[model samples]
Target chain A: MRALTWQGVNELSVETVPDPTVQSPTDMLVRVVRTVSCGSDLHLLGGYIPFMRAGDVIGHEFVGEVVEVGADVRRHRVGDRVVMSSFIACGRCWYCRHEEFSLCDNTNTNPAITEALWGFSPGGCFGYSHAMGGNAGSHAEYVRVPMADHTAFTIPDAVSYERALFASDSVATAWTGVELGGVAPGDVVAIWGAGAVGQMAARVAQLVGAERVLVIDRVPERLEQVRRYVGAETIDYSTQHVGSELLEATGGRGPDVCIEAVGMEAHAPGPDFLYDQVKQQLRLQTDRPTALREAVYQCRKGGTVFVLGVFAGVVDKFPVGAMMNKGLTVRGAQMHGPRYIPRILERMERGEIVTEHLATHVMPLEEAPHGYELFKDKKDGCVRAVFTP
Target chain B: MDGSARWTAALVGALGIGGASVAATRAVQKARPRPRPDRWHAVTVDRAPADLQGVAAAPPEPLAALGDDLEIDLRPAPGDRGTELRARARRPGLLVDADVRDALRRSRSLLEVGEVVQPDEPGTTRRTVTSLPLELAIRHGREGGRL
Candidate 1:
């Protein structure tokens, strides 16, 4: 089977690998139909995540048809069209019981790796580096899905495969941000980065009754998409002062909730950008928190700041005083995909969310490297690149 | 001695007997059978193949030869992803109908939701723990991925 393997920094190749077989009674084998490139993949591609190896397959968000089911997999049958949550959960742990699916104690087969990193380990995530369980990614003809009953959902007939693909990760991720930030009626929500996740976050905020939603980015097309498709105000940070503009728009109160959808490798303007760049290059800091810092700085006092961007390591010069003195609340999570993907699917069915536009470029799985390049460079307004196997 | 002295001596003797009776009752309670923290499993470091030993909750030597419906527990070290088995289990295994690990995991599901529930197909992966950097801050951030 041909799969995209991560060779090294900025290197991706579609190589032939052995096809996956079901190894557990609770496992199912899925022939992938569509797998999409994620912005988080950029962190892995850039060598920011150190756990990635030369032959590791890379992709997470995907939808497919169940070709085989293990003996214990009761919920799904062969030929079922399913969308798998990026995060693999046991669906039996204490955390899963409380709907904290990502934090499931049993699913991370490589708990020590994550336990060494995060105190305890989180549930396994597909193709997200060894830190997230090192499960083979979905960017292949067939991949084995462990704990299939809860991690993979049968897509409703009303939802298209393209839209269902987003529900696997992007939509659920944005919904997790909204759910965590507690977007409320009449609240102003500001999201940093107008990429796929941020775009979805903006729409989700509106769907949840946020009165005003602002998306900030320097990319013209992305800002335009946010304005048009997502129905949110846009801010070109390169042109206007994001903080001042947000403050003025909110009548000086600042956005009630600020979501930082841009992660560690953010490109920021000014002297601090250079500071973070040098530090990042020298390996002195693991992440560049320009957008996160700005989110904390620009949020209204006592408001919440939800970080949706992936930060693999520590950041330098976090404004603890601002976070403390202003009585700000900070929270973040890997998307509890299994918990929220169903709700996202319901919303998608109701026509409250449309995702076909996010798949700006569609290509064969063999051309995955090109997809990555176009997405990394933001070429052709490619918010997401969906690949068919 | 006067009547007052006699009365005081009687009172002191009665108090002594009362104290001894209380102490005796506590001793009897202590001697009665009480539950020890259930050690249904014990940890060992011996390198062993669990599948070869079958489902014996007890150590190989004692329970290996006896096959009267057994249960076992072979797990990875608490924080170490199953690089090596933690070498644990109990003897006179719990009357379970499945492998010890599966039984415990299933029982957990049943207790939590009244049925064994799963999100994905249950399958096994080779337990390989590659040597990676183990900085607390590095691993901690990966938990509950903030992004």
Candidate 2:
């Protein structure tokens, strides 16, 4: 099996690895048809995330055909077209029952010890770092999916794999942010960082009937794309102040909801400051204070702020006072792809939300490293880069 | 001096007692206050520093600085002024002006304590400083600044 592995910082290699097989009664083997690079994957490439070792398969968002199923896998059968969730969760766990699949008791990626009989220390992830349950990822010809009944959703015949591919992570992540932000009819929503997640979030906001959706990003082309396809108002943070623009657009009231989509490797405005200095000196490659600070400063009072972006480590100088004084509601979690995939697929099938626009480029799996580079550089209008296995 | 006089007197007394009881009940109800939709109201404060300061006191001068074309008006309360802000901008409307107010307010706070400032806006950006014994809020006109 050919898979893209993380060799080191700024190093990704596509090599022939052993094919995956069903290891547990709950496991299933998927022959991947399509996979997309996640914005979070940039953390691995930049070495921002911890414990990402060499030869670790590096992908989490993909659609595949189930080639084999385990004894306990009842919901899906062989040859079923399915989109696998990024996280592997036992549907029977307390957390899974609550739809908090990221925190599922029996499903961490870290190796389990006797003391932790059921749950692994690292949360289960497809191709994320070892810190996230170091299970085999989907960026290969074949990958094993644990908790197969809970994690993989069979796509309807009408829905194309190209559209359903994002259902696993990018679209689901945006849906998570939208749900957390509590978008409603006639509400004004602002999303920071017009990456794939941000674009999808803007679309979701529209689908939920947000009266006005404002997407902020420094990239002009991406903003234009969002405006055209997602029907969202774009704000070039490079030219305008995001916080002020949001207030202006919302009539001196900041957005009723704000979503921070630019996670850990978010670019800082201007040169390195004290916080940047500390991070640089500490050899930390991740942390973006500007975006989070702006989100806090720009969110409306009594409104919800959802953090969907991945943050690698500690963040300093967070504005806890503003959050407290304004009576704002802040919530964040990893996207429960298993929970959202079905809803996103339904929306996609209805043509209410288009995931196809998000795919800027598609290439063979052999060009996986190049795809990673393009996405990391954010060049060539790389909103999303898909690799076909 | 007979049965008719006694009946009238009893009826008058009964009416007086019933009226007094009704008045007492009304007073109690007024004192306790029942939940009503009209009574339930919420005031949202925008996280922008300028708006926060404006609601705390008077509107800032930067807001007032917006020009007349912007149609900047200040309403006391419970008016649809906020709605007007959204309707005004079609193609890059009042968004720039609002941003300027936020920038001015941010810059003012940075200047108040005599801190060396790196201007958010490039070149020699100008600001009119007014010092009061305490903080005096001033409102800006729409389309007022060089934004």
Candidate 3:
């Protein structure tokens, strides 16, 4: 099988790897039809995440067809077109019972333990790294999926793989963020990071009946895309203060709900000396506190703040006092991709959510590294990239 | 002897009865459990991947003793062995020896590391001792007994 592997920082290559096969009773071997590079893939290439080794498959979020299934995989069978969740879950744990698949008790993709299990990890992304369950990614000709019945959802024929791909992660993550933010009908919502996830969050917010949606980002093209496709009011953080813009957009009351989709590598200008210190710290306090802190401070009293970004290590200096003083409710989670995949697929079938617009580029699997670079650099209006295997 | 002696004996008997009654009341009072004080401290730590650049370190002072009643500790990785903190209070008639442990078994941050500490043993003095991964232990110490 051919797949894209991370060689090192800023290094990637298309290499031939062994074909994937069933490894567990709950496993399924999917013949990948389409997969895409996520914004998070940039972290692996930039060496932001440790233990990502040479030749580690790097991609997550895809739609494919099950060519084989293990005996215990009763939910799906051969020839069933499906979209996979980014995280592999057991689906029967206490957390899964509550639809918190990301916190499954039996799963190995957890951030803390993944490094020991695999060379690298990314919250259990497909085709990303070994640390993320090391299950071959969907970027290859064939990929093995563990806990198949729990992680893979059948995609209806009415939905195209291109449209269903985002359901695997970006759309699901955005929906998770919006849901966590407690977005209600007629509520004013603000989203930080107008990337694929942010855009999808805006779209989902509208679907869930948000009265108004505002998106913030520095990329002019992405901001424009949000305005044109998502119908969201946009603020270029590069040119203006996001908090002030959100406040103005919400008539000075601030948004009732705010979502941070940028994750750990969120860009903020500061002294170069602070960069290393900031990168090593991963708590909610110091990791990209600007947008999140602004969200906390600017949220309407008694509103909710949802953080969907991936922060590593410890965080410092969170605005805890303000969160308490304003009576703001803050909640966060890695997307329970398995739980949301089915729902997002149904919405896609109804044409309620248009994911195709989010895919700005598509290429063969061999060019996967280039796709990562383009998406990372935000070049050529690269909001999302799809890889056809 | 005389009528006066007889009267003194009778009064002494009555005083003995009163003393017995007081002693029984004190014993019952001592047997009852003491009410626990309302004291809490909020603690939070990052549970993200370790390799990512800019991953924040645990607080310089992770442990804190708040208001002389509550203590908190935060760490980087709560670890496989799990971690715990002990909290205690003093009250009359309480066993004061019973240990009280509140196991934070279902924390998202704790992951597989179960039981922040075994649930507090009852009847002990009010003192909270938290045991977590080394990073959090140090962090708690640096926080000066505040969350």
Candidate 4:
């Protein structure tokens, strides 16, 4: 089987690897149909997480066909078309029962690695580095999905694989932030980063009745996409003052919900960008909190700030004083995919969630390196690169 | 000449006493290995205390593998948490922290999820020179958190 592997920092190669088998009682083998690249993958590609090993398969968001199922898998037949959540979870765990599927107690095989880092390890996530669970990623000819009853869901007949693929991670992640941030009807929502996840967050905010959805990004095309397709206002942070703009947009009150979708490796303008870059390169900080600090400072007093971006470790220059004095509630998590994927798929089927446009570049899995180059560099307006194995 | 001969004999006698004392100490140490930390390793299972009553006596296969070398205790966790399964090695043979934690973690998974989830089997990762250290770390890293 051919799969894209992480060779080193920013080095990806499509290699022929042995095919996966249904290894566990609840495992299921899925033949890849469509897999997409994510903004977060850039961090893995850049070696920010440090858990990725050479030759490790890299991909997560995907829709596929079930090739085989273990005896304990009670989900679907072998031929069923399904969209899998990037995060693998056991359906029977206490966390799964509480709809916190990402925090499953039984999935992460290498828990000690993340346990030492994050206190408690989250569930296994495919192609997400060893810390998230060293499970083989979905960007392969085939992948073995464990505990499939919860991890993979049957794609609705009306939904295309391209549309359902985003539900695997992007849309579900956006919904996670929107709900967790407690975006209320008629409340204003401001989101940082106009990538696929940020676009989805804006759309989700509107779907959940946020009166005003504003997406901030330095990218012209992404801001355009947010305005035209997602029907959200755009803030070109490269030119405008984010704090002043956010305050002005909300009539001096600021947005009720502020979401930072940009992760540790962010592109910020001016002197802080250079400072963060130098600090990150020097290993003085594990993550950059430029967007996070801005979110905390710009959010309305007593508002909620939800972090959807993936951060590996501690950050410097976090606005602790503003976060405290402003009566803010800051929360972040790896997406609880199962809790929201179903609803997202249903919405997709109804033509409410349009994600096909996010696939700016489509190519074979062999061209994954080039696709990632376009994506990582944000060249050719590559919001996401969809792959077919 | 007599004084020199006496000094040499005394030196040999001192070395002999020291060697004998070292051998005796090693023999005693071998009879009883050093103890690990006295802290009890515990996991809170979602199952009620009633289900875990007398669990130490019967014990699951994980704890049972340690046999009498491990001591087991079960108590109800406060505020509807669950049963707390606590264990500590009795004489430190196979119940090292890593092994004990893995066993306890597997016990929790087995009881909760009905089975332990396997990681990617027949791992497809082709070994590179850089990957060896991560693989080495993973071999010793089964205990999820509290590791």
By lDDT, the best candidate is 4
Tens digit of lDDT per residue, candidate 4, span A94-188? 67878888998788888888887777878999899888888888789999988999999999899999889999999999999999989999999
- Mark the regions of model 2 whose C-alpha exceeds 4 Å error after superposition: A111-122, A271-281, A284-286, B1-147
Shift of residue A191 alpha carbon in model 4, Å: 0.1
- Cα lDDT, model 3, residue A22: 67
Give lDDT for model 2.
0.69
Model 4 pairs whose backbones collide: none
User: Number of clashes in model 3?
Assistant: 69
Q: What CAPRI grade goes to candidate 3?
A: incorrect
lDDT string, candidate 3, B1-147, tens digits: 797786576567546645664686578657986333533222222233332122122212112111233233433435521223223333322312122221121232233322121101121111111111212322221121111
Best by DockQ: 4
**Docking verdict class for candidate 2:** incorrect
The alpha-carbon deviation from the true structure for residue A272 of candidate 3, after best TM-score superposition, in angstroms, is 10
Top-scoring candidate (TM-score): 4
What overall lDDT goes with each candidate model?
0.78, 0.69, 0.66, 0.87
- Tell me the tens digit of each residue's lDDT in model 4 across B1-109: 5977765765675466456646865786679855446768888887888877767888888878977889988998898678888888875454677778888988888
lDDT of 2 at A354: 80
For candidate 4, what is the recovered fraction of reference interface contacts?
Answer: 0.72
* Greater-TM-score candidate between 1 and 4: 4
What does candidate 1's lDDT look like per residue over B48-143, in tens digits?
A: 344324333443433343244444455543442221222223443333322333334333333333333232222212211221222232233222
Candidate 2, residues B16-75: lDDT per residue as tens digits?
644664586577667885633222112112123344444323333443344332333223
lDDT rank, highest first?
4, 1, 2, 3
Summing lDDT over every window of 10 consecutive residues in candidate 1 chain B, give the lowest-scoring window.
Answer: B123-132
lDDT per residue (tens digit) for residues A1-389 in model 1: 88898876798999887778877778889999999999999999998986776677889999999999988889999999999999988785557766888887666645555554465567778998767776788888888898888899999999999889999999899999998998999999999999999999999999889999999999998898898898899999999998789988899999999999999999988999999999998878989999999999999999999999998878999999999999999999989998888888898889899999889999999999999999999998888999999
